[model samples]
Target: MRLKIKRSNEQRLITLPDGATVSDLLNEIGSASINIKVGFPPQTIDISDTSKLLTDSGIKNGEMIIVTDTIETEVPVNKNEVAIATVSNQNDAPYVQIDDIFLVLRKIPDDNSCFFNSVGYCIFGPDSIKYPDSQQELRQAVANVIRENNQGIYNSAILGGKSITEYSQWIQSSNSWGGAIEAQILAEYLDISIWTVDIESLQVYKFNDEMASRFCVIMYSGIHYDAMALKLDTSLDEEDSQICVFDKFSELGTLIEDNVLKLTNHLKNQGYYTNTSTFILQCQICLATLQGEKEANSHAKKTGHTNFGEVN
Candidate 1:
C-alpha cells in the first residue's frame, strides 16, 4: 500500500504493508532520514490515537496523512486570566507595570550567539551538564527548519539577496546572527511562543502566537537578548527547585499584571537600555570608542572583544 506523508512544506509517497501499524509506518519513515530531510527533530505520528493500526485509523491505500510537529500538551491554565487583560488603562497602550512582579534575568555571553544561547537557557535552564551543546544544536535546528521550508515561507524574497541555500548555511554559521526571524522559526520548531520584550521601547514582539503551547519570555535590548524567568516566590526556600512557567501572555498579564514593566524598569536601572543614538560606548578592553550601540556591536564582533562600557 502507498501512503502520502505531508510534512514541512513538502509531501512524499511511501510504500507500506497492508497490515502495518501506525508505529510500523512511523518506524519505516523514521529510518529513511525523514528528520534530516524535513529539518526537524523526529516526530511522533498522530493518527488521533497512536496505539491503533494504520488501517484502524482509517488510513487506506493512497490516503494522505498530514504530518505536524506540534503536539498539544495538557498545560494548566491560570483561570483568573482566561480573557485578555488590558495592558494599560490609558486607551490600551503597549506597556504596563505590575505590582509585586519580579523576574530573574539570565545573562548569556555577549557573543554573536546570544539569541540562540538565551533560547537554549530558556528551554534547558542553566544546567551545563544537561544542555552542554544546546546553542549549537538550536543553531543547526534553525538552519534545518529554514531549509525544510525553503520553497514557501523561507524563500529568496523573504531572505533578501541570499537564496534559500545561502540563508540555511548562514543560519548555522557561528558568526552569522540570529534575530526575530530566527526566533519565530525556533518558536514554531519548538511548538512554543516566544515573547521578546524590547527594553528601550517597552514593546512586546510575539512569535508563533497562533499555535504556542508554552511561553518563553526573553528580554531584548536593542543590541542583545537575554532570558527572563519569573522569580520564584520569596516565601519558598531557595532549595526548592520548582519554577514558574507561563503558558500564555494572557495568563501572565492576569497573574503578573504587566510583566514587561518590571523587566523594562530593571533594565533601565541596570543601564542596559539607553537611547542608542546619543549613547557613547567605549571598549574597556582596547579603549576604542564607538558612537552608538550598533557601532559598538560591529566593533565587538570584528575585534572579538566583549568588554564595553557606556561613556556618559
Candidate 2:
C-alpha cells in the first residue's frame, strides 16, 4: 500500500512503495540523506519525525504529511558521580583512586589483589587464603582449587588462604537477598577486609559533596548493584551502562568449580596441602567420639592459661 510518512525531527517528505515494512524503508534510507521533497519549511516532514505526527495526527494514505522539529536542551549528566563526565578540565580532572577502594565494587575477585591471590590457589580448603606469612604459596593453593574443581567463585571466597568458588556460587543463586549477605559471611569467617555496611546506617556528614553523590547511589542500591545509577536520567548515557564500573561489587556466585575434592586438589597444587584447622573445628562441633574436656585440659596445661574453662 502507498504510505505517507511524517517525522518529528529533521524536515523532509517521503513516500513508501506498496507492501513495504518499516524495516524495509529504514534499510533503503541508509543514512540521513535528502531523498524526496514533500512540503516547504513552513510544513517540512521526515520519516524520523514520525513520533510527533503519530502522537498528534495519525498517518493517512495519499495525504500531505507535516513534520516538526523540536529542539530539546540536553540534560547535563556530568555532574552525577554515577554518570560519566566529559573531559572539560584537562588539567584538574579528578582521577578515581581505585587502588584502595573495596566496598562497592562487584566482580570482587577480579579487581582486588586478595581476590587474585585467592583465585590462584582454588584447590585447598581455604582456596588461596592470604596469610601474613606466605602469599605466593597461598596463590598456588587457590590455583589448585580451580584445577581440581574446574570452576572458580565469581565473588570473593577466601578461607584462611584457600579459595572456595563453590561456596560463593551457593551464596549467589539460593539466597533471596542476593549474594552480599553470603559474601559478608565468608569475609567474616576469613577475617578478610571486605567491609560492607548498609546505606541506611551511613553518616552523610562524613562524606564530601562528590563522595556524597556517589555514596547516595550506592546506598540506594543496597550495595547490591555493581555500578550505581545516577539520580538524573541523562547520566545513564554518559558511560557504557554495562561496564560503568570495571571493579567487581555484585555478589556474583562461583563461576568455576563444583565439588570439594576438586577444590582440595587445587589447594594441594598451590602447596596448601591441608585444611586441618577447618577439619579440627568441624570435628570439635560434630564427632561424638571426641573428648572436648580432655582437649580443653590439654590446651590449658600446655599454655598455662585459663582460657579452656569455657570448654568444660
Candidate 3:
C-alpha cells in the first residue's frame, strides 16, 4: 500500500508492503521523533506505539498522513463542556442553549469572502431557501445597496476615501474584504441587527439601530470572519449542525449578550484570536514573514498574494 506523507506543506508518496507499522514507516522515512496523524479530522498515532499496524490503525492506502515535528491536537467544539439544554424551537430545529442562547465559533472558509459568507450564513440559516448559494451574490448585493439604496450616506466622505462608484466596484471584486460599512448596510438590508464579536478586544459592535425581529452574531478574528451559531453536535467526525438566525426577544437578547461574553472569554482562554496590530503574519505564497495586517496588506497588493497565516 502507498501512503501520501505530508510534512511542512510538502507531500511524498511511499509504498510499503501490507502490514507495515508506525515503526516501519518511521524507519522508512528515517525520522525518529515525529507526530503522525491521518484521516478526516485526523487521528493521532502514537509514535511510541510501534506494534500497531497501519491497516489496523485506520491509515488506509492512498490516504494522507501528516508528520510534524511538534505534536498537535484538534480543538474540540467542547459542546459538552458548555452547559447544555436541548429543546425544539417553533420551527422544530435542534439547538443547544446556554441561558436560552447558544453560539459556537464556526471556521469559515478563507476564500477572502469570509465576511460575506458569515453574514449569508446568519441571514438565512444554512438550510433556508432564502440563503444565497454563493458569497458572490452577497457581494453583489452589497455593491448594489451602496449604488442604489443609500447613495448619499455610503458616499466618498464615509467610504474610506473611495468614491461611491469605486467602492461599489471594489465590493464586487472577489478579493475585497468587508468591514463596518458593509455590515451596517447588510444588517439594514436584512432588517435584522448584527452583533460582530471582535475577539481581539472582546468588543461586540452592534449594527442596525432600528428595531428588528431577530439578530445574528459573527466573530472577527483579526483579518478573518467566522460565524457564531448554535452547535447541535460536538463530535468532530460529523460536520457541525448549527443554527445562526434567532428571534429578537428582550430576554433572549440579554441572554445572547451574556452568553457571548462567555463565548469570547472561552475563545480567549483557548488562544483562538489574533491581535491584528501585533500578530506576526506569513505570506503563504512566498513564505515571507510580515509584521502585522498593515505589512500583510502591503505584501498582498505588491505581490498579488492574498494567502496569509498567523505566525506564532
TM-score, prediction 3: 0.60
| TM-scores for the candidates | 0.56, 0.19, 0.60
Q: Which candidate is the best by lDDT?
A: 3
Q: What is candidate 1's CA lDDT for residue 308?
A: 67
Global lDDT of each candidate: 0.61, 0.27, 0.68
Q: If the candidates were sorted by their TM-score against the true structure, best first, what order would they fall in?
A: 3, 1, 2
The TM-score, computed over Cα atoms with residue i paired to residue i, of candidate 2 is 0.19
| C-alpha positional error of residue 123 in candidate 1 after TM-score superposition, expressed in Å | 1.3
Task: Evaluate residue 85 in candidate 3 and report its C-alpha lDDT on the 0 to 100 scale.
Answer: 33
| Tens-digit lDDT string for candidate 1 (1-312) | 887665433456898888888677767556333211121332334444546777766567876454433322333444333221223232221222223323455566766677887876665444421333557778888878788885577777787456878788877766556788898988887777888888888788889978975677777877677776553333221212322236665555345334455656656665676687778878878999988867876886587665666686
Model 1: residues with Cα > 4 Å off, grouped in runs: 1-101, 128-132, 155-157, 235-244, 249-253, 274-312
Worst 10-residue lDDT window, candidate 3:
71-80
- Local accuracy of candidate 3 as per-residue lDDT tens digits, 1-312: 999776543457899988898778998777776768775324577667787898887778888676655421122333334463333333222233453234556567776678988886665334221233346766777888888844467667787566888789888876678889888877876777888988768999989846666788988877888877765444312223444656666444545656776667666666667778788988877999999788987887677676777786
